[model samples]
Target: MFMVYVSETQPLVDFLRSIKNGSTVLMASYDEPATKLSEEARNLIAEMGSTYVKSLGFRDNWVFVGAKALPVKLCLFQHIKNNDKTNVYENWPEIIDMDGCIPKHME
Candidate 1:
């Protein structure tokens, strides 16, 4: 598998839908100001995520959408042609290897 990081999902939806099974995508990283989000905006974002995920359906393909925090914007995409899939967390050792910061969730 290989990876791609995107800030917005709409632009990559087409390309993502065309990828073979066992692929993974990382999107919508939550940053420092995430705490400033209003409850209404959070609800809207959540709804949008569900819609985006449903639009791109591949049985074995996986997509990780997040409002989670990362060292930067939380985005990672894994490209797998056949069945060579790996745990999403395993893809980035640096997250675990960091001095004090541990990523709570991938998405």
Candidate 2:
């Protein structure tokens, strides 16, 4: 299991690319995840089974759990919109929590 707080796109993309197949990855956003996010990074995350990555916006709260090189059914994620009406704080969405068991990788 790996936990990450996405702040920079390059490091995140490199990290995502380096993980072995069947490795579990968990990611969340801090202040502003998309400010410096790149298309490659978004595509990478989307390929990891994130349905919301392409639409992720500034200050949106996001959390994702996925298994590298695994099927999409092995992924779980959620995001909270940071728009004016949905934000809990100025320019930020409300915090979110997620919990589940990921199937262990078997050789």
Best by TM-score: 2
Global lDDT scores for all candidate models: 0.32, 0.76
lDDT of 2 at 36: 73
Which parts of model 2 have CA positions greater than 4 angstroms off?
1-8
The parts of candidate 1 lying over 4 Å away from their true place are 1-27, 50-107
Residue 41 in candidate 2, Cα distance off native in Å = 1.1
Q: How close is candidate 1 to the true structure, as a TM-score?
A: 0.22
Deviation in Å, model 2, residue 5 alpha carbon: 12
Clash pairs (backbone) in predicted model 2? none
C-alpha lDDT of residue 106 in model 2? 71
Per-model TM against the reference: 0.22, 0.82
